[model samples]
Target chain A: MIEITEVKQYPFIEGKNLTLCAPNKDNLNLYASWDNHPDARKYARNVFPTTAGDLKKYLERGQERAPREIGFEIWHKADCKPIGFIGFNFVNWADRMGNIGLNIGDPSYWKKDLGMEATYLILEYAFNELNLFKITADMYEMNTPSWKICEKVGMKRELTYMKQAYVKGNYVDTYQYCLFKEDWEKQRQKFEFK
Target chain B: MSEEKEEKKELVCIPFIEGENVALAPTNIDHIQLYAKWNNDPRARHYARNMIPHTTEDLKKWFEPRGGLTEHVGFEIWHKKDKVPIGTCGFGRINWIDRNANIYMNIGEPEYWNKNLGTEASHLLIDYGFKELNFFKIYAGVFEPNIRSWSVAEKDGFILEGIEEKAIYVDGKYVGARRYRLFKEDWLNRKAKK
Candidate 1:
């Protein structure tokens, strides 16, 4: 006879290979590892060192719904583990717009198209479910892969700020990508999204 | 009448920055009703793009200090002569590492509009951001139809950074939002020339 345990995940939005779920405190250790990882932190815009205690506090606060921010944890359907995070950070309800943020924490999952799928899922939820008019994303010019994922999701490069951000002792340009709901509605059909 | 008097007695204005015509003061929790009035007033809230109705309970949460490093700093606009709070203004979404923040203001009292108070407030707040707060830059966004706001931004020497197309929805139509930026170096140079 054998005993087995299951990882409980509360999936809020399901995707092809991934699902966005409510962040669980049981995964704090995994979240801490990702927050401290150099490559992940660079693209995630974590300027200061993040502690486990900080992550705990964040999880505790996440229990309540915040008016301006809505976040979710990305659970890899096949792997049975949380691999990333994605959400709308600045939701302007009156203007019907939001700023999107996504972080693929697991290094093993990088460049696997999981992030791209997650982006599409979130966009559908934003426009179709939430009725957001516009969605915007910002990224460092050096982070080509991140911006590429945004472009594949029908986002356009709206503006470039010269030397707007300082990262690792060097100033870098920041790019803002925007997509309107009406335009996404027209393009989502091409992605086979009903 | 007695209850109103009790509420008036609780109102306290603590000036943080003083200008000739208006002084920047910490927001008084006792004046949540007044702020709610301004937030819901049709004529006053039109240019501010406040579409949602705000209740006193909703505003109390906003006024409550979220302890620790705050990303926002709001102040009540106090008229010197009349000794009354006419509106509110401050910096929101402050990026400490990047040394930048978004500045916004609303003259809630319609009678106070076009009195150069906004110009005075902008000058005082901009000076405080650069000199006292050691901020590198400040950003502002004005809806395309808001000529008065852009005029004040221009008078304060803010340069047009970019225009976000069809970003805001108003009156069943979409409108662009004009972005303006002011750098500390440019402000200093302008002052030297003056």
Candidate 2:
């Protein structure tokens, strides 16, 4: 339901000491390699390696899906390299809600608060640009670092299921977290990007 | 004897108990006013079974054995900013056989509703249930009219298990009750992906 052609490039979002921007064609290789990272794959729905050609095809398909799903590779404006990917997928226009999934592909970017900054950038896109009312996300319970990012961005944990998913021949529990547009608006008012 | 002591020390170091920013301690008679406020809320009354007006005796009866096997353990949700109690959250109808439990939460002060306090408190309680109490699943039975609560549950990762037909009698009318649940394993899986 999203008008993909209408999707404009998101300018840099200034944080306390960082800026998040949309990745360009030049960084596609970096984005693909980040996606293929085993550590990043651990929490991702897709586990297979992503080739540059695959990345191009994927983005082409994304454009066809239009406003319903959008992907953006996150980059620090200062460095200009892709650090992660953040996006809204399975957007339901009728309900004004969407499933949000993101990953900080580069381990070097971990724990530096870049994830939080990227999250805020995407949230702005979801609520301000896309007019979404609710955004939901799921994470493995043991992935404390990612959950910490969720927490920092004000996503609230709503439920936890035990051993509900079988991954890599082992069962694990999943946690669902969400943030409402209103809540984000309120938080944005008080949030210091720094 | 020395070997046994070493085993005990190792177990203690395992960090079986998980703590959260929101602490849910056992309630006392001193919390009577807080309980009364929650019980009087129209929305709370709409979901709760009709009972006699809350009295001092009722408070004592409720406070007694909150930590007991059969009774509900109530906790006053406190503000992390000032440590001032503002709401209530806890578990009831603990089913050991099914390894499940019922959860309820209320921010008596309307101002705090949707302010992330409930979500934070709920997350803390959920971690307690999954990590400390070892509950396999956590569930909530909510009135159909409470869309906000439903959103909260959905955000927390609770899946809609079922809807009971006219399961609750509130304000002289029969109301439908929607059940939401989160399994421990599923929660872990979702968390791991994040």
Enumerate clash totals for all models, in the order shown. Answer: 0, 41
Estimate, for each residue in A1-194, the C-alpha lDDT of model 1 and write its tens digit. Answer: 11115597899998878889988777777787788788898967898888878988876663344368887899988888889889987898878899999989878899988888889989999998888889999999999988998899889988777667778887677888999998998888666422
lDDT against the true structure, each candidate: 0.86, 0.69
True contacts kept of 2: 0.00
The TM-scores of all predictions, comma-separated, are 0.86, 0.48
- DockQ, each predicted model: 0.44, 0.02
Cα lDDT tens digits for candidate 2, B65-94: 435366365677766544545666788877
Candidate 2: regions farther than 4 A off: A1-20, A62-66, B1-194
Stretches of candidate 1 off by over 4 Å are: A1-7, A10-14, A60-68, A77-80, A192-194, B1-15, B29-33, B55-63
Find the candidate with the highest DockQ and give its number: 1
lDDT at B82, model 2: 43
